[model samples]
Target: MPSVDEIRGRIEAALPGARVTVEDLTGGGDHFRCEIVSDRFRGLSRVERHKLVYAIFGDEIGGPIHALSLKTLAPEEAK
Candidate 1:
């Protein structure tokens, strides 16, 4: 089971200088919601941004991490 902080770390590491927030949606480590803001996402399509984030998790996505709801934004899109 991956902890929220662990997930946040992975995302932050993958997107250097990104602002990431991870929430354990169901009080379970496997279910999560992530909000990511990064300059790397600038000009990328939504699918492309998602794919980038998903790649960091690899096999863990449908396995240990059962569900991940993502809100990805470029720096300018962030509030």
Candidate 2:
């Protein structure tokens, strides 16, 4: 079970300059919802963008982290 800051840190570290917001939905650290904005997501499909973020977690997605809901966006798509 990862902390909110830990999840945010991992995403930020993986996508330098990205704006990441992670919330622990269950309060147990296993379910989370994250929104990430980054230039790296530009030109990528929605699935591709999600895959990029998901890759950062690897096996942790189904292990300690039970569910991770993501909202990935390119800089231009962010508001």
Candidate 3:
């Protein structure tokens, strides 16, 4: 199981200047919900923004990380 810190680190590295908040939805290590706001999301559609966030997870997305409920937005949307 990846630590929350580790996951957050990976996301941060993948998307610079992203503001992320991760929550464990279950007692198990797999389920998580993340709120992500990044400048990279600017001018992107919702699907594109979510895809960007999910890409950071790579294979772990469906394997180790069973679920990731995401709320992705641009910096402007966040404010």
- Candidate with maximal lDDT: 1
Q: After superposition, how far is residue 31 of candidate 1 from its true place, in Å?
A: 0.6
Estimate, for each residue in 1-79, the C-alpha lDDT of model 1 and write its tens digit. Answer: 9999999999989899999999999987999999999999999999999999999999999999999999999989997
Per-residue lDDT, model 1, residue 3, is: 96
Candidate 3 accuracy as lDDT:
0.85
TM-score of 3: 0.91
Runs with alpha carbons beyond 4 Å of true place in candidate 1: none
**Candidate 2 CA-lDDT value:** 0.93
Q: What does candidate 2's lDDT look like per residue over 1-79, in tens digits?
A: 7999999999999999999999999899999999999999999999999899889999998999999999999988888
Better of 1 and 3 by TM-score: 1
Question: For model 1, where is the 10-residue window of minimal lDDT?
Answer: 20-29
lDDT of 1 at 58: 99
Name the regions of candidate 2 deviating beyond 4 angstroms: none
Cα TM-score of candidate 1: 0.98
